[model samples]
Target: MARNKFDVDENLEVQFNFGHLKRMMGYVKPYKKEMIITLVLMIIANAAGLLSPYLMKEAIDSKIPQSDKMGLVVLSLIILATLVISGVCMKFRIRTMARVGQCVLENIRRDLFVHLQKLPFTYYDSRPHGKILVRVVNYVNSLSDLLSNGLINLITDFISLFIALGFMLAINVKLTLISMIGIPVLFAVILALKNVQRKAFQALSNKQSNMNAYIHESITGIKVTQSFAREDKNLDIFREVSGEYRSSWMKAVAIQFLIWPSVENISTLTIALVYIAGVYSLDKTITVGVLVAFIGYIGRFWMPIINIGNFYNAIITAMSYLERIFETLDEVPEVADMPGAVEMPEIKGDVEFKDVHFKYDDDKEILKGINQRIKAGSTIALVGPTGAGKTTVINLLSRFYDVSSGEVYIDGIDVREVTLSSLRKQMGVMLQDTFLFSGTVLDNIRYGKLDATDEEVIAAAKAVRAHEFIMELPQGYNTEVNERGTRLSVGQRQLISFARALLADPKILILDEATSSIDTKTEITLQKGLETLLKGRTSFIIAHRLSTIKNADKILYIKDGIITEEGSHEELMAKGGDYNHLYNSQFIMLKAV
Candidate 1:
């Protein structure tokens, strides 16, 4: 089972302030023209809303009281015209907003997804796919809603409040001011709630991020938990994480409920005070229509206040996500080719490591002053105890990570000074763990070189002795290998991958513990395949079996990141050094077995 790789405190910040939502609105800069058009339509729509109170007033006070048929007809027609305007303008505004929302989402997703590919492997090393995916997609969706619907409603509420307030005052100034008495109180409440809601929303968002990370990690290690009979223990852990998320959600909801009711009660109390005060203080003639509109405006005014308050958290939270997205996109990938870096001419397979020194981190030295040279078309084996930096050397040679010191040269060209893409193209690598996507066998082979023909694939397969078994399968080359090629045996998977590496026709090759998973019989057959695979390529082979690489032109024994010995198999055995001790012990273990 995988160990717990992250703590809750580690991800809390991502939940709270995504950082500078206003800065992220820069993504909508491209859609400015569309936003302007939508804004015009929305303004026209809101303008028509001001006519609502007037139309009702006319219908009741003028049209109905006058009983003039022509006046009523004209008034009805005008009301109908305003309604038509609102409806049509609103439709145009909504359609344009939707289109812009979708486009903005697409741009964000595309930028994030592409940036993910450019991130260093160290990123994926620390984060699970599920955790990062949930954060990326969920945070992005939150931002979209805030930018689209949240923005639209905020605009609508402001427009409605102003227009309604203006029309109300024109009809009955005293009652309009009286009804709006609690507005400043509402504003004060929102200002207070802004800080509380920001904290609450931050907690809620963080809880979700933790839940996603927990669920993803749990599922990935589910097999290990079940195999070890620790399912109950795992379930308990999951329950704790899930319960924490639930508790946070409830707290946030409680706070939200608290906010609206407090505002509503204050608004109601103001209305009551106005009504009581209106009768006693003045003999103002206020109609039912104007009073009703003021009452409506009272509620409407609180909406924008409350909305801006509630969305303060959302805005802050979205800004945090925006900062992370931009931060990642702005970072330069490691191991990019240097400016003026030249592509080396076709390699003759000669590879050199002149005092290669490396480390994954600064504090620890994984390799130290390692030196080696391989002639064109020769196999070299690296033997070492665990942590002896064997794979580190191979990874450095492949340019996955540049050496911390010293240099690697391919055919006399310094590897670091060559275009990274061009340098890596000369090497083929297959690790102990094989990676196969869901596809036909033919498709997998063709992955080595996208434009390789079917004839070349079959020829490559036959060279590796994979063609015989492939033909025996029901669909031969057409057979579907499910995710990670689980349909095939470990040995068969190795063979397919070997064939893939050979098809690349690279001048340099790395086979890191490639045969460790295969059975002995399959290993022997694979040994034959390896001979053909290494015929013209300069090869570096690392294996625990030791026997497979005995034919290596040179064998190097590594200890604590330094090469302690180097020679042919017999020469090393004859030397009776650390190499001899290892060989003798292995021989004794073999006889005992």
Candidate 2:
């Protein structure tokens, strides 16, 4: 069993990309009407907020001093009416923005998922499932607030600040100027802390991705852990990973907490200065009521500043999420159709490799100048030692990773020349490691053909010799297969996968050790099924058991990325080449066992 490496020491580098923000905002285009309506409501709410202080000024200066009960009642009523209007506008604005935000979020997540699906297999090979999951799920979720409330709150806060500042300057310019001195200081402090806060959030996001990767790997290999009695060891590893995640989160929280206190202190000091100025103005041109109202407006100004600071924090955090999301979005698929790539018609399954050269890295070649041709409807068995490029051949045929040089052709059309979907839709692949989703046996088999009927699924199961065992289950075909088909025995999972492949009825079928898990009896039955299934389809079988290829139309003995020998099993055995050595060695091993 492999132990997960618990290293959280990687530097979390990220950009607060303005271009990504612009691209993200593009999702809001569909909801423009909702956005405009929400903005209008926000403006109305801010306008009401703006009028309150003026109403207070009027009551204190005109009505209360004159003992004018009617005027006081009118002003009081106007204030109360403004409060209700503001409350109503705020409530409606929140609802509208939330609706728009959720719609935008849905669009983003949909695009993320669809784009991920479209990405080439190479992209997946290079990244962890956990990291991708975090970007698709948690990171996108983080943007929900920024898209909805953060945006609306940002707009309203600025509007409130400007309107309140206008009133403050109007009431007493000197006092307003005195109060505004702290504004630059607050901004300077925020700017100084921006990078630190961003780094903290980036660390937190990275830690989250790391923790997810560890958990996913651990759970997937839980069987091995339990079998080896390594649960305590894995738990210790999990604790280390979880601790790193918590520490990163706290670092972000610490940065966030730092901002509020700093802003509050500056605002408090500014308020004291405003009070001093107000007191001196009492004997001057400013009235007591105007001074009081100015203080109210000053308080209003600082609150928005505080809110904007918080929004700024949110923006920085949201920017980190966008950075990660766009990073994945920016990845160009390694194997994508060329411009105007034609959709392949029904394939005749004539596979040809013309000088195919491939390497996952420049340092070492996995396949070297490979050349071969298979007639339509012929079965080609690839017998090779491990790491001898058998799987790479099948991968090339499927166009999962394009050959570094040269071409793979199907029915005289270059695999790269055809649209991937049109080409891949006609091929079926089964691997040694069977993977079944968490669903019914019927559902898993139907995955090969989503529109397959229940009857058709049963027919496929019967064709692959899985029908008997499936019927023994409590729900028959409806019996749920737990994740990775853990609820089923290894042989049973392979049989279901065979059923899945058989249902697809592809023109080309690639089986890489497809029967490795099957017992001898199941393999015997499967061989009988394969005799019919391989009749018209072009099949590529990568098998370690030499006996399995004895009846193959042709067997290619591959070694060190080269086909050293190719012939029927009987002919290769007579030739006494590398294939003969491999066969006899395997035969002797079987006899000894």
Candidate 3:
């Protein structure tokens, strides 16, 4: 919930605190049993792997020294058999761990999705869909690597390193200690490069999010970009953004590239320095078998050292997203009713707004101290200039946002005291923007009432005069509506929306300029459908076309978030108030068009 945006450092690293990481660890719970079994297999595989060098030492020292040819063959065979078993076991471990990782990722994704639906309207208002998407994808992906490969690598490396060190020490403690002289230097090198790797990956993740946002926006607004002739410019900007991703990838590789060479050089120097020290002692205690085994252990030691460094970065990055995901999951839904609150009462369509005050943000009030009461089955027409907060009244009625101050009562029940789902069930809303998903016309109309029959869908569509036009298409109700219903005209989309709201059979209706985009013929045709849909419902209409609401029970002139005048059309004109003034101002334009 921190308001701060992600800011990459000079080294392009993102920092995660202890609290964030600790919470992320909870994701490991479900896979604990599988993880435990995989860990055991990993230890067995690594220990068996370390045993190969010991088997080699025995093959060279005893079998060769005594010239036992059969014993030598049998030892070699046993070593090969152990390796085969180890490889199969390692493969099983990989497969099992991978399943566990996938399960965790699936749960995390599901949990994030469910939590998103529970967040407040304002949470979505302030955040972009793309940023949340990046957090979900990048965060969950980081955990997948650790749960599958990182954990396995870590367990195997630790076991192998311990077994190798134990064998080397048993043979010659002095030589083993001398060989380990590079340990501190290796640690120092890994520690120095660790942040570089972390920062590089963090930068890559952020850049990728940026690229994703650009892609989403460009695709969604492809028409605008093409109409403005800016595709090439967009591509150039995208290249600039993608350039950051390429640089970060290179930086990560460069940091990791140092580990192998540096480890090899240090190990070679340590071996030479140790052999020189032993030479002066004139001791033949150091066997060739022991030296060979020590070399193998040195290889094992440096690999884990390098891997541990990289794993640190993965854990850090994964933990960052974990924090965000958990934060979302922990969010308490804002519009939830009180514990003892009741379901909505049977509404009679009577509504009262007692001094409602609202602000989209703190400093800019959108609605201020407005009071009104409407009868059970009356139609109220709201008229105002653009940005006069008329639409905000409809938003409040539907409880999209809680008023900053005031009470809105439906059927004598405070809206906040009733379950949101129950409260919303009685209201049908059609917005200024018509949104239709990718589905058939039948399905889209049925979206308002999921169990609505085919007959009902056709009825609702016919009511809105959408059925005739729909049948003119190739498949009628089954016709595929592409994304945003792009194939249909804006007015046509609005008609479908009106049908959807009509099918819901709500007690109260809100028409947010439902006919604004449609032509005159279409609007006139829809009048009967609108009237049928509005019959017996407490309705609120917001439209630029003042003529549509000429039969409304009352007209409320709203300005600066308050009701300036209220009367029927004839009454308002007779009073010669703000409503009459506005009506007179628009009379010429209404006639001309």
All candidates: CA RMSD (Å): 3.3, 2.0, 3.4
lDDT per residue as tens, model 1, 441-503: 999999999899999999999999899899988899999998789799888888999999999
For model 2, residues 1-593, the per-residue Cα lDDT tens digits are: 11222254323334567887789878988888877788888888788878878888888888898999999888888888888988998789878888888888888888899889988766665556777788888999999988888877888788889988889888789988988999899989999999999888988888888888788778878889999999999889889889999998998989988889999999999899888878886867788889889888888999989999998988888877888888777767778888989999898989999998889856489898889999999999999789999999999989888899999999999999999899999999999999999999999999999999999999988887889999999899889888888899999999899889989999999989988878888888888778866779999999998777788989998899888899888899999998899889988998999
- Candidates sorted by TM-score, best first: 2, 3, 1
Candidate topping TM-score: 2
- Count clashes in each candidate, considering only residues at least 3 apart in sequence or on different chains: 8, 0, 1
Pairs clashing within candidate 3: 13-199
Candidate 3 lDDT, 174-218, residue by residue in tens: 877887888899888877876766566666666666666667667
Candidate 1: regions farther than 4 A off:
1-7, 11-19, 93-95, 266-285, 296-300, 316-334, 337-348
User: Model 1 compared with the native: what TM-score?
Assistant: 0.88
10 residues in a row with least lDDT, candidate 2: 1-10
Give the better candidate number (1 or 3) by TM-score.
Answer: 3
